[model samples]
Target: MSEADARLQDMELPTALYESTDDGYLATALTIGPWDAGLQHAGPPAALLLREAERAGAIEGGQTVRMAYDIFAPVPVGPVRITASVVRPGRRIELVETVLTAGDERPLMRLSAWRMRARSDGAAPEPPAPHPAASGPEESRRELAAFFTTEVAYHRALDWRFPTGSFNSPGPASAWTTPRCTLVAGEPMTPLQHLLVMTDAASGISAVLDWTTATFANVDLLVSLHRPPRGDWLGMDAVTTLGGTGAAQCTAVLFDAEGPIGRSAQSLFVEPR
Candidate 1:
């Protein structure tokens, strides 16, 4: 396999492909698409795509871009293409966009990198409370070799648990998540990585035994990482707020055995299975 092919076939995106030119690499995550379960469609794979772009120097740090994604029909489980381009570059921020396509359909996602700007003394946003340590389920040591994604690999390393839900349930579920390992790939997890793990677990929310026959997919996901997860064992206590009219949303409070780390919410499209 060529370097481009090697990058695409790298197991990071479940089953993705990569194309290259004089400019940069274009990757496509085939098996995992918009129609796949949220567990697959939303997570490290998407983040990895953006991170790959950053690593490729197509985008710099610090800038905000609205990432609007559309699910034109259901994304298939074959080959998909991810092509990225630099939109704007500035001293403090940069804008970039990447389009993921399978066959003839196109679903695009955008990213904005905003580097920290030097500022004088002024009022700053208050920091979030520390995440509480794993007391009940999060602390339990468990082996996870079944899950294929690297995100799940880290989950097992953290020794957390999902007290209730499974992947395709109806209501909210609790995930005893923690970082099993640190991000040796340069800086700690980018906000994109955090968002990937944060949004992927919604299916487990309905893990309660009674809510087993329902499923939902994210319509939109908004993530604001006040500070990246520095340690392992980030726990997620999640629940659904409004899931109707072919759409749903859920909220989760992330923790890491200190107090409260951060909060995340995702809008989902739902259906009965």
Candidate 2:
């Protein structure tokens, strides 16, 4: 844990969470999650699935409009396999399915995304309401949950700034984040990759429960984009709500320096750790 004590800028971070292999990838310490050192966080793996989904190809000039992921089993911090294929292909829209698996051939996670070709007539989506009180990213504070041991990898590998409530604060919050390291070694981080890697953190960043005593783990993540995002810095204005049935949900307005781009939702199972 001492290794992560140094601030991100003061320490050289690992380049990527996974290294591409013939079958899939090998997980590195950089992917460690907050809850367990042996399990990888959801964000990086979500990004990896999107990367492969896009690579499998979609309609010509297609843009990803929605992506959904389901995590049924723990993702181990070791070698894993991934595969992507087009499930529904058409001239105007397409759907892709990607699966990540660990040893024994059981899936660690399953994901699906929808892509659509731009309207040739230049039609656009209905505009979204502007965030009520978003300050610039520069005005945000640098912080995260203090109780999390320094050994956690994914959160520390990136820079986070809160323009509203912080990771330590239990309430609705807004923050800007950008990864300090590349998503894959010797490869570039695409716009979609940049956004996916950070969207999953919304539940943690705006958690309304004490993380030390309670567990609020998201079982799924869904992100819908109205337009392509620009730049590396991504922002989210998020909130979490819990029900009496031990079910919870987190919602976030996703954006970049340019403006509003999309929204993210995560479903959680709440219980004592």
Candidate 3:
């Protein structure tokens, strides 16, 4: 194994998905997704872009309220470049755009985030009701070997537990997940980054169609947060809807150990395998 790969294996949690290089960055195995060996999971690139956007637009006491990602091409596992810029700078609210591209500058994904100042307010809206406590990862661990036969690194890097549906079955499902690696090595992942990593699991957690005979590729991921999440465990109560047409949607309520913090939605293009 390469030195970089060796370093990644030593970490309990993947710190980052890519290692910096002279030109751009190298996509680690940790960035691999379920669909293909060459393609990466959407969460890693999204989180990476968010990290860059946050750096470009430094919000002192602000929190990300909304993040929208458009996946134009399959994010391949190799050298990639990322760029971020402030679209709308403000004292109370800021808008930032971040893009990811291949070595040849082929656009892979684009993310837009809205960050707003956080302050104490007596009239703040009440938080959503928390989902009932479920089994922890230890008690409810579910193996994903059957569904994801490929050697996807990110799949093995996370601990997943299903309370409603198994990976082989298809239906509305609820799951709790915790990452075993950091987004980038050395740089600790923030709560927001942690949440962003799990937000892309909407389609896998709740599938409206069969996995063997159908393919549901999420084209976009939209997440809105009401409050900052706390703790290692993230919950996803997801439901998927399929139309007669070739379009589908998956929506999920996001949660930390405490309660509901936000929601995430994904637009999927369904096709027969």
Please identify model 3 stretches exceeding 4 Å from their true place.
Answer: 1-16, 124-128, 132-139
Full-model lDDT for every candidate: 0.46, 0.84, 0.81
Per-residue lDDT of candidate 2, residues 145-177 (tens digit): 565555448776578888888888799998888
Per-model TM values vs. the true structure: 0.59, 0.91, 0.89
Residue runs of model 1 more than 4 Å from their true location after superposition: 1-40, 56-74, 108-128, 132-138, 141-160, 163-171, 178-195, 206-213, 255-261
| Backbone clashes in model 2, listed as residue pairs | none
lDDT ranking, high to low: 2, 3, 1
Q: Write the per-residue lDDT of candidate 1 for residues 1-273, one digit (tens) a residue.
A: 445435535544322222343443333332233233322344534554456445534323442323333333443433445676666655555555555555564564333433233344477856656444334453444333232343222232233366554344446666665443322232465444544544555444433322334456665544444444444445676777654476766777666554555566666666676
- By summed lDDT, which 10 consecutive residues of candidate 3 come out lowest? 143-152
Best by TM-score: 2
Error of 2 at 168 (Å): 1.2
Candidate 2 RMSD to the correct structure: 2.6
Better of 1 and 3 by TM-score: 3
Ordered list by TM-score, greatest first: 2, 3, 1
